[model samples]
Each structure stands twice: as structure tokens, then as C-alpha cells.
Target: MNICRPYLAKLCSTLSGGPVVSGCRWVSNGPRFPFHSVKDIKNWDLDSDHQILPPPSTIFAPSKGRRTRHDNFLDFKRIRVTAGGGGDGSIAFSHSAVQPFGPPCGGNGGRGGNVYIMACKDITSLNGILNNYTAANGTMGSSNNMHGANGEDMVIRVPVGTLVRQVQAPIYASSTAAELGDDEGGVEAVGQDETENADEDEIDVEEQNEIYAEQMMRLLEKHFKFKTNYRPREDRARWLMERLPPKPYVPPPVLLDLTVHGEKHLIARGGRGGQGNPHFVTHEIKGPAICERGEKKEPVWLEFELKSIADAGLVGLPNAGKSTLLAAISNAHPKIAPYPFTTLNPYIGTIDYSDFWTMTLADIPGLVEGAHLNYGLGHQFLKHVERTKVLVYVVDLAGKEPWRDFEILQAELEAYKTGLTARPTLVVANKADLPRARSNMEEFQTKVQYPIVPISAKERRNITHLTGALRSIVEKAGAQG
Candidate 1:
């Protein structure tokens, strides 16, 4: 406990408190102790009220009577993308000073720039800058057998929660929805009789409409004729709904922008350069230099949108050991210390249940009093939790009253969004290493009538038990579904 005081102090110093500042001195000499730059922590303000932090639409909500920005402002909405094309090879001849007899020389083209979306645990907020993004291909080669410089590649940065989808590939009920438009247009034109006595024009219009309709019908037959459907009407509707474009991943019932983060989609990309004529002027042949061809252009449209952040979200009051548990259970390496509200964003970790079943867990930022009303850091981090299927509430058993902690958290969740309480939940008690934790754990069990497991994440105690229990619960839900 003496050794831990300094670490605890450092955590408090990072937070907005006096006690934590005093505790940090002991940790200064410890090997595992961390000293973070104040700059890194500037983005986070523990004292800020998040729940009432301006209702995602109010432009500014008062924090201690001062106006503040919307909670979702930190959430990114835009991400631009660009790809590089191959560089053109230069065509030149090597002429000796004496003989001056060299075959045509053409360098090979530089390979096209490859693009990738690397998975990261932190660094979300892609949706914030998705707008105004662009990518370009590599340049063509020069004349003196020098290959043209390759175009610079543009990588589309996105949060870990983002999934890439092609631009608006609408799957129709069937390709041939009965050739409704062409025939209907002709019928309407003929019926209107706007062109009086113009029978020839009407006949031409009729023939043209029939041809257009036939072409459309043929295209549909060619593309969708082989498709098969096995689902019910409701399932079909659901599938369509799934395919339907999302209405921008906004905080539910918030005033985030519809124009910038809305239905916009990428339409086209820059074309690749044509080949230079150096391969045709071969020595064996008459002209190997002229035989080479330029690369073909690849113009494609791409669309990306933010999806739900994670499947399971870990939430609760401050100092609940959310970060410790996250680091212990998965590869995620969130900062952990004996303090509240250590995490700012929703940290993600992948929990592999089996070869076939793997689910992601989100360590949502800690909640405090009046979080939903934007009372603290809770409001800023609450949106990330909205998409989770399961909510795990971590309670500090040793620090304070466990049942009161639970009640406070319940109130915070309800205040933020009413539906959050309805999600599947598990109440967990942390810090079992402390002597006083057991009695508090038992009391919580009796009062809540739900199974409560006590654990010490820092000590690595009961970690396996906690993980096994979580797996059982998650898998059971899957089975029932």
C-alpha cells in the first residue's frame, strides 16, 4: 500500500484533484510509474459537465453557467481518400561518344501506390473530417529513360470502429421490377396528346420507349436472373433496411449536422496515365521502344461511414478499474492507475471466444454525477456506448459504498438516455484486494439480487474467473438469440 501511494498520487495529479497531486511523489521513482505531459491531458477536463454539455444541438450548454460546445463535437464525421497510380517510364537511347549506336532505352514503370486501413485501438473521430478528402495517382516517366515520378498516395484515415463499404450498391428486389418506367412514359406521352396530329412523332416515341424498356429489361435479366431468394418478407425488409444507408452515425436525438456528415458519397477517382512508347523499339524487331503501352486508368467511387463502436461496453463510476480490466482481458493497452475518469475516449479490445466467435469490447470513459446532463466527462463519452449490445458496470467495492455507487451509476445512465437502462447488463465489483471489499461485495449481492464477482485487476486476482464468467454470459445470450 505504501508503494502504491505515489502511483495513486500521479493519477490524481493528472485528474482535477488535490489528493492525487500529493500521491504522485511516491511513484516518481517506481519502474512502472508514468509521467504524462500536461499537453496530452489538455483535451480532457474532468470538471466539465458532459450530460448537459449543450444537448449535442444547443451549440453551447452552460458548464458552471458558461456556454459549451455539443458533446458530439469530438466525434469526427469526415474522411477523404486518395490512391496513387503507377509512374510512367522514360524513353531514351544510350549513345556512345565514339560509336553513338545504342538501342532505345525505356525504364519500367513504378508500381502503383498501395493503400490500406490499419486497425488501431485508439484514434477514432474519422467521421469528423471525412469531408474534403482526395487521393492522386503517380506521375508518368521522363524522356531520358528516366521513369516518371510516381503520384503520391492518399490514405483515408478512419477510426477503429469504421467499416469500409463500396459506394451505394443498391440491391434491388429484382433487376426487372417489371419494366415500369419506359412503358409508363410512352403511355403517358401518348395519352396526353400534347402533339396534336403529330402521329409520326408519337409512333417514334413509342418505338424508342419500347427499345429503351427492352434494353433495361435485358440488362436486368443479365445481372439478376440467376439470383435466388430464400428469406421471408420481414427478413427481406430487414435485409433491405440493413443495406439502406445509415442516417449518419449521430448521437441519438442530437443536433449533429446532416449536411456535412449526411448522405454524401464518393463518385469517382483520378485516371491512371497512359503508357509510353519504348517497348516497341526492340533490337531484334525494328522498333522495341515504340511497342510499350501506358497503364490503364482506374476511376472508382468509395464510401465510408461510422458504424457502432463496439459490441460490449464497459462502464461505471470513476476508479472502477475499467482500464485495468481492459488491459488484462485483451491486447488493448489503456492507461491504468488508481483514479477516476482516466480514459477519455471509448477504448476498444477484441475478446476472442473461439475460432468462430469473436466479439469486441469497448471500455467507455467513466461516469460521474449528472453525466447525462453534461455534468462531467460522461456526456462526451456516452455516445460511444450507445451501440453496444451489452453494458458491464464496474463498481469500486473498497473505496466507497458499493450499493450507493450502483445507484449513482444507474441514475447517470438513465439521465443520459432512457433506453440505455434497457440494455443487457452485468454488475461487477472491483478492488477485491482491499480488506473491506468482501463485505461490500456481499452487501451488493444481497441488495441487487444479482450475482456480483469481486476482483482485483491490479493484483491479477480472479481475472480468469471474471473472463470465464463474461464469456459464459455473452455466449448464453448468443445461444438464446
Candidate 2:
């Protein structure tokens, strides 16, 4: 158990003219310097697991190449979740050498797995979620009356502040299947042409019963291919009990909002297992031969919408320097460019104050003039700011009409939602270093009613005053709420 590093110990022994301690190999550094200096210990083992690194020339490319694009950050997505199906019951009788014929000993099947959804703070986007999810199937029963094993349940974790809503639509599309109902699974009306063509109101009680009886006869024939004896009244009664269908899948009435971390909700429930042959043994009948079939769960469609939750939101038009302002204040690296529409998605950043207090902010994509009417990057990015306690507007002081841009920005927000502009707000006049910025700020101050703060984000000037003002507003909002 050598306490010193392998390279250090080797260096010590080399200088002192003493033998090196070979046992120090256990405490050596990994990957890069497993056995530090190959030339120092000149015995090169070519076939060892630790190989030498390639030359620096091969690692770095000489010429510049076109960059590859990455997938966009997804905040809204849809998924289909299907629960596992129940296992079928067994139909078998125990037989031993002592007794030629024994009583029925069939086992019942196991139920399917359930699906759950949970909210986690670690997850930030919906891009990782799958388009479809299917749970494991239950095992089949055995002849010795052993029950089947249940399927494994599935849990899906998503980011907090997610809204889950079940999509409303018909589970099945075929005319025959819809006529028979959702729980039938093609068994209620196997030959469904007559039932689908005729109107339900016109068909009386007697005609409906007659049509159902005919369908049930066809169902039995399809289920059993071989010739069997189900003619007796007792046998017929036992056979009908085994094919009972599961209940229909019903959608949730209200939308599910997961605001807190670690919150969970059941999205889909599995079907119940079928009954075995012995379960049908009544006083009138000594032994029942029929066994129930397992039930299959229908697939449900759901939509997940993730709305960002932050203390303040930065809103502006394209090339208005909102992204630049966010980068200067907080520890967030949002993409910045001179052209318009540089930010493709909303970016979140946290500002750590000196007193251990912190404020979170989101940089939303630029809003176009007709953004409320679905012109460009419409309400998609607008909803991300709905949960903020304050709104921060960043306007370009270098523009020809700075005050007109401010009024249009406020109008767009008001159009999206009725009272969105009524919250605590701040206006920022960015690019104060430009030639016309000083004169524009004076005219803009007179036209605008809100308090205006002038600062050059590119130069990183006067940021302390802006942050102090924001902290006071945030503190006031926190106290009132």
C-alpha cells in the first residue's frame, strides 16, 4: 500500500540512487498518465492495454468545414401510451396415477402493468421523451394451477411546470368496431356488416337481441376451430361467462398541471386478469370446462406542453439585443449574432446576487409585428413568459423610432393575453454607445410612460444600477405574493 503516486515515487528513487517501489502502480493516475513517461521506463510493452496517444497532427483538422445542425429544442410534444394486456386463464385438470380422473385445477392469469408520469427538476426539455410507450405483457398460466406473473410497470419523468392533457378522439376507427363498442375488441360483432348498415334507433329490442345472438354464435365458432361439445345448457352457460369484455377506456375531464418537483400522476391503468375454470364451479354443475380470456387495454393519446417558470422574462423584437442583455447580466451563454432571429428557442439563466439571493430569467425569441395573428414564431414562444412575476422589455435605442417599437411590443403582449402587460415592468434602452442613441433616449423618455434605464449591453456599462432596480421590484413582488 504505497501512499505516494507512482511517478513521484519513481522520481524520488531515481534521484536518491535506490530501487523503485513497483507497488506504487496501484495509486498511479489514469488514462493520460497511467505510467507517466514511456522514455523514463524504456521497456516498451507493445501488447499492453494502456496504449500511447496518437500524435497531435491527426487529432486536429487543418481546414475549416461546414458545421452540422442540431435538433431544435422541443417544448411541446405528443405521445401514445398503451398499458399491458392481462394473461389468459388455464383450462386443465390434475391427473395422478392413484386417481385416473381428478378435479379441475386451472390457475388464473395475472394483471397487466400500469403507466405513470412524474415531474423532475433535472429534466429541462421534452426532446428526450419517446413518441410511443408500451408496457410488458403478463405471463401465461400453467397446468398445475400456477398463477401467471404480472407485467412490469413503466415510469416517465418530465420537466416541472408541464401540462398533461389527454387527446379526445375515437379509440377505434372502423365502422364495425365502433358499432360493436370500444370494449368488444372485434368479439361483440364478429360479422358486423348487418349491425353497421342498420340504424340503431330503428332496430327494436327483439331484433337487437336476435342480431347479438347470431354474432355470439359466430364468435364461438371463430374462437374454437376444432369440434367441441358445448350443446348442453350447463356447458353453454359456463362458456358465455369466460368471454366478458373489459371496461372502456375513458379520458380525463380536466387537464393535469405538474408545478412542483417530484409530483406524480397515473396516466393509464392496466386491465384485470381473467378468471380460471374452477372459478365458475357452481352447485348445479360439478366441473366447468370453459376458461376466460385475457383483456387487452386500448391505447391512449396525450399531449405534453412545457411552460417555463421564472421570476422575470426578457421580451423584445428581432435584433433588439435581448440576448445580449441576458448574457451580460447572468451566467448564461445564449447565441448572439448581428443579424435578426439569432435565438431560435427560449434560454434560461440564473443571476447569483452577492447576498446569497438569486433571480431566474428567460430570454424569449423575438416577437414579430403580427405575432398574435400567427405571422412568425407566433404564440409558440409567448406562452413561456406567462408564468413570470415581472416583464423586462429591451428596446434598441439605435433604431430610428425607439418609442414606436416599445408601444408595438406592449400591444403584441396584450393581444396574446388580456392582462399580460399589467404586471410589474421595466424598459431598457440598449445600445447607448451609438451616435444617435443619446438623442433618441431623450425623445423616447418623454414619449414612454414607464421608467426607462439606459445602458449599452455590448460594452457592459452601468449593469449594476439595472440589476439593483430589478432586485427591488422582484423583492416587492415576492412580498405581495
Which candidate ranks first by TM-score, i.e. highest?
2
Best by lDDT: 2
Tens digits of per-residue lDDT for model 1, 1-481: 3325443444554433233333244323322323445443333333353211112223233355432232233453323343455555454566789747576665545545544444344445553444444445556555556665555444444455554543422235123343343332332355445445456544677665555444444432221111133222333323323322222222121111111212222223333343444554434444233212233233233444443466678888877899998888787878676666667666778876555567778888888888887777556677677777777888888866888888888788878888777777777788888899877776678777555777888888887787777777776766764
Overall local distance difference test of candidate 2: 0.76
Looking at candidate 2, the ten consecutive residues that score lowest on lDDT are 25-34
Per-residue alpha-carbon lDDT of model 2 for 1-481, expressed as tens digits?
A: 2323654565544333455556533332322222335453443332354432334353334655443221357889888888888777777788999966787677887888888899998887898899999887676666778888898999989988789988754455345446765323444544366667888787787876666665565554433221156533535633653644534557564378988899998888876666667776668656677666666787777899999888899999899999999999999888889999988788888888999899988898898899888778778888888988989999999999999999988999999999999999989899989999988988999999887888999999988988988888888888987
Q: Write down the RMSD of all candidates, one decimal each.
A: 20.4, 11.5
User: Least accurate stretch of 10 residues (summed lDDT) in model 1?
Assistant: 253-262
- Model 1, global lDDT: 0.56
Candidate 1 has what TM-score? 0.44
